[model samples]
Target: MSDLVSIPADAPTQGMEPNGWIVVGVPTNFFATASAHARSGPLLGAAAEVRFTPVGFRWDYGDGTSRTSASGGASWAALNLPEFSETSTSHVFEQPGTVSIGLVASYAAEYRFAGGEWRAVQGLVLVPTTPIIAIADRADTVLVAESCSINPSGPGC
Candidate 1:
C-alpha cells in the first residue's frame, strides 16, 4: 500500500487534572479521549467506507516539553494514586504562569469499497485537539483555626 490515506479523522479532546490553576513543582495529569469512527465517501467512482482507530496519543505541555504515550493517562482516583503524584502523561511546571496544554491523536485507518474486504492504510492520520489553557501557581501550607470553606476571608483562605 502507498503511504497515504486522504481520508481525515476526527481529532481527540484533552482533559487535565486540577482543571485550572496547577501548583508549581507538582505533577499535573493529562489524558486524551478518542474513539474509532467510520465515514463513507466516494473513492474512484465507488462507494468507500473508511474507519479510523486511535492508536497513539501525543501531549504538548506548552512549556517546551512534550510526550507520547500508548495509552491516555487516567485520573488520580481512577489510577488509585494520591493527588500530585506522577503519571505517564503528567507534566510539572517550574514557574508560575499560564500555559496551553495540547493533545494529538494518531489513528490507523482501513478502507473497503462496495462492501468488500477492508484494506489497511499505510500511514496514520494525525489530528490535534483544541488546546486547553491552564494557570500554574504556587500553593502554601498554613495551619488555621478553621477550614477555608468555613472562613472565606480567613488568612490563606
Candidate 2:
C-alpha cells in the first residue's frame, strides 16, 4: 500500500516583481506555494486521499548560497518587516547578473480515506517544482536625484 503512494506531483506557483531588478546586497522577495496543483480527489496510485501543504522551501540562489524558508515569506511591504525589509523567504544577492534560482519545495502531507479521519504523514517530501526562476540582479549604480517612490519616472530613480 505504501508503494502505491509513489511520488505525487505538486507544482508550485511563483510570484515576484514583474520588472524591478534585484539590487546587489539588497534583499528581494520571492513567493511560492506548494499545494496540490491539480486534483479533486485522491491522487492516482495512492492508497488514500492526500493533501500537501508547504512546510518549507529549499532555495538555491545560483551564487553558491542556499537557505531554507519556513513560512515562504510575505512581501516586506505587505508585512512591514523592518531593516532589510524582508519576508521569511527573502534572499540577498551579492552580485549583478542574471541568476537562475532553483527551489526545492518541501511539503507536509496528510492523508485520509473514505469515511476515515485525516492523519499526518511520517516526514516531509521535497520536489523540484516547475521551471527554474531567473532573477536579474543589477548593480545599484543608477543615480536617482529623487526618490523612486516619489516619482517613478524620474531619472534613474
Candidate 3:
C-alpha cells in the first residue's frame, strides 16, 4: 500500500548567520527552508494525491555533535535577533577547522485516493539537506601599532 505513493527526496536548503565562516566558542546560527508539497499519482489502482509536510529537523554539526528540533529554525533577521545570537538551531564550534554541517528534515505525509478523505501514511520521510562547508576560526585580540589595512606590515598586521 505504501508503494503506491511517492514522496520527493528533494533536500532542504540551509543558511548560516555569518554567511560561510564561523568563529569558535560563539553561537553560529543555522536555518532551514522547506515547504509542504503534493504529488499526484496512482494508488490502489485509483488516482491519488500525496502531501508531505515537514515535521522535524536534525542538525549534524559534523564535529561529533548533533541535535534534533521540532522546528527547522529561522534566520536571525527573521527572528529579530542580533547576528551571532544564540538560537534554537545554533551551535558552538569548540575548535578551529573546516567542518561539514548538515540538516535532515523529517516529513509526515497524508494521502487521498479518488477524491476520498486524506489518510495518514504511517511513517515519516527523512530527507537530508545539502551540506554546508564552514570554516571555523578562533578570534584573537592583538595590540598593534596601527590597523592592518593602514599599516599593512606593522606588528600584528
Q: Give the top-scoring candidate (lDDT).
A: 3
- Model 2 ranges off by over 4 Å: 1-9, 18-20, 35-47, 80-84, 131-157
Query: How many clashing pairs in candidate 2?
Result: 0
How big is the positional error of residue 51 in model 2, measured in Å on the Cα after superposition? 1.9
Question: What is candidate 2's lDDT per residue for 1-157, written digit by digit as tens?
Answer: 2432464747566655332456677677776765553223544444456667777878787788888877665554566543345466777887777777777888777777664787777777677855455556566476656787887645343
Error of 3 at 61 (Å): 0.4
Task: Write the residue-wise lDDT of candidate 1 on 37-126 in tens digits.
Answer: 988876556678888899999888888989999887788788877566789889889998999888889888888988899898887878
Give residue 9's lDDT in candidate 2 (0 to 100): 49
Model 3 lDDT, full chain set: 0.82
What TM-score against the true fold does each predicted structure earn?
0.82, 0.68, 0.82
Q: Which stretches of candidate 1 lie over 4 Å from their true place?
A: 1-7, 142-157
Inter-residue clash pairs, candidate 2:
none
After superposition on all CA atoms, what RMSD does each candidate show versus the true structure? 5.0, 4.6, 6.2
Q: List the residue pairs that clash in candidate 1.
A: none
